[model samples]
Target: MAMTEPTIVPESSAVSVSVSGAVVGGLRDVPTTTLADLLGRARVMDVVVRPLWQPVPRVAGPAFTVRCPPGDNLMLHAAVHRAAPGAVIVVESGDLDFALAGGNVCAVAQRRGVAAIVADGLIRDLAEVREAGFPVFARGVIPIPGAKSAVTPLNRRVRCAGAEVDAGDVVVADEEGVVVVPAARAEETLTAARARLAQEAAQSLDDWEKAHRNRIDALLHAGGHEES
Candidate 1:
């Protein structure tokens, strides 16, 4: 969980990058499968909050990240306006309190072609978020409202999901958990993650067979004793 200083993300690089919503689209994707294979190599803490949001229809691009202050969403709106089509917005709401973003904001993101929203704070209006099929992940849910003063700065480096997220960082989240790949290191990390997944998938198949055999053996042994 090492955090480095915030780095500036240029709007142009993000805007022109090919939209690759399938960046880590399915559990079968290289980086995703690699994460699954590594198992303990990834800590769930690295994924902030409850994994309970409904799946939003995905579009495409790398991820765009932003850090916001607690209970204030000025920067969040800014992030939405500037976010690239395939970008996922990651917000670090200090202390994990307050409802920083909700349905109306999600609607805005949807219109802007944003892919997903991840907040360390609560989000309200589940129905609207779900209805729009906008993917959202947060610490929990609350009925609270947030102030809109644009107090926090946009596109700064901040910590979320036990990892540091700066603008242009790659964020991939699924039912398993979320992982951050620093922009500078994503290409290498993705290659590594895919390798780990292939090795792990083979191991998983072997383990499942072994466990099944053990269960059958125990059942047979108990039947023999009862018959005798």
Candidate 2:
């Protein structure tokens, strides 16, 4: 029996639409916590995919989702070229045995103006990635390289870090974690997040104490505790 080479799918096969730059730019400063709060803490990605370095601020942009088999990075390679300048490449690799990205890919993605990368898989070439100053959040690091034989689809809805991400969805990642805001709800979500942030910023210690005291008093009163 002879082995057959895998077919490389054209970039057009993947469904992706460039999100408006204004929309993506508006979310540049929106914190992941704010987005999480807007979503009721439901759309945040798992904590496993953490930033490779500390003190790195936030990265926000439209998502360019990639669904690929573990140990294969062909789809990711394709996505890097197809993604919009400010898009964040989100990869859903099932396992961590193989490193799906490394220094070379980071350099290419950086030169291409990719906002960042968030993968539910391992990556290698930490030194190079760090030197390139590309923001990457992933499960962990591994020395083993991945195969490029499989050509996975790009820009489709995919589950990454236990969260479902769709192409054009707003991805906001910070020191805390990553959160997704559905494209359809970006405007309203942004409004709500801004309001919430303002409210939190204006809240004083006295206000917090009063709110906590009121809650505790209500609980005690409901339990029939009488004050002397």
Candidate 3:
């Protein structure tokens, strides 16, 4: 069956106020994968993703910000024109109630050079979205359509999973998971994350050897006691 576009409910939504240069250049440089590693390191609530039903093929990209109400996707349609190459649109739905993204948008996003779509709400049109093959991570996939009555301010700062994301934030997603790094924090995060990865890599062999030796010694010690 052909996938149909979901109806979006429009609402009177407002964009968060930002002072000069607050969200400007808010795009971060840390690899999206690096942030996922850091989250594992610190046990932080860093991995903020909706639900993963279908997998979007891995691709490189920057983040485009859009704030919308639950079930409203008006602003998202507008963002398609403003998106840059390798851009991923991060939709912050006010509450986790509506299906904010779906298949039709996925087709448009891919055509506009979007790398992925991350939404805090549900998504519809799973088969087409997967067929289009634009990476999408949402709360889950629901057959329900979205409401278009509420307003969704484009290129505004909005809270996503306790982290504030603005337009142009660097988004990286892969098999491990999704991570958002602020433009301001990218350099530092990347440097530190790289160092940590290198250190772990260098020590991995030694650590494994040590564990093997310990296991052998423990087993020998048990055999000796039994013989005695």
Candidate 4:
């Protein structure tokens, strides 16, 4: 039998996401916590991947997916240029010891209008990035930079942190966490999330407490627990 090589995503693959602007925009201001409630725990990224800096702005956009095997970060670096303006660069990184990118990489990405960088691994130069106000969500920071020799696919399905992200998936992240709305469900998810936000906004704290208490009591009763 002959072996076939895996297809490498084109160099220009960063401009690849096809999610509608309306859907992406609708999700932009939606909190990741709310989206997690709607999408369930499975759609949430692992807690390890969090905003690298405090007071970081929330970022939401169509995902430009990239996969970089451990110890190398070629694809992520390449993605900085290829991703569309306002696109969120989502990286599936296998390297933890090496920093995927540093201040310069982030600066260039920001300059190019890339909305943000979401890496399932470490980054470096946090002070510089924070000073520049570039939003980055990652595991942590490492001073050692990763090599750029390994080549991998871009704009493809990627397992980022604990979530499965595909090209065009709507990724919304904030201090709460990162939530991926599957590309196919972007429009409907936005609709439902907005509705939930409206409902929450309309409810008073007392009303919310009353409803919450009732729901908890019903669950407790079902579990055969009695309130004393």
Q: Which candidate is the best by TM-score?
A: 4
Give the per-residue lDDT digits (tens) of candidate 2, residues 53-75: 77666998888888779778878
Models 1 onward score TM values of: 0.69, 0.88, 0.68, 0.91
Query: Which lDDT tens digits does candidate 3 get at residues 26-114?
Result: 22333445566664432211355643654544543556777777667666766666676577787777445557767777788888877
Clashing pairs in 1: 19-61, 20-61, 21-60, 34-193, 34-197, 56-133, 60-86, 74-150
| Model 1 residue-pair collision total | 8
What candidate 4 gets wrong by more than 4 Å, as runs, is 1-17
Where does the lowest 10-residue lDDT sum fall in candidate 2?
Answer: 10-19
Q: Poorest 10 consecutive residues of model 4 by lDDT?
A: 8-17
State the lDDT of candidate 1 residue by residue for 84-141, as single tens digits: 6767888887535567777888999988887788777778888888787787877777
Candidate 4 collision pairs: 14-82
lDDT (tens digit, per residue) of candidate 4 on 1-228: 996644446843443436788778889889998899999998999999999889888889888888988888888888897888998999998578999999999999999999999999999999999999999999999999988777776787899998999888889999999999988888888889899999999999999999999999999999999768
Better of 2 and 3 by lDDT: 2
The whole-model C-alpha lDDT of candidate 1 against the native structure comes to: 0.63
- How high is the lDDT of residue 213 in model 1? 88
Between prediction 1 and prediction 4, the one with superior TM-score is: 4
Q: What are the RMSD figures for all models against the true structure?
A: 8.4, 2.8, 8.5, 4.4
Clash count per candidate: 8, 0, 19, 1
Say which prediction, candidate 2 or candidate 4, comes out ahead on lDDT: 4
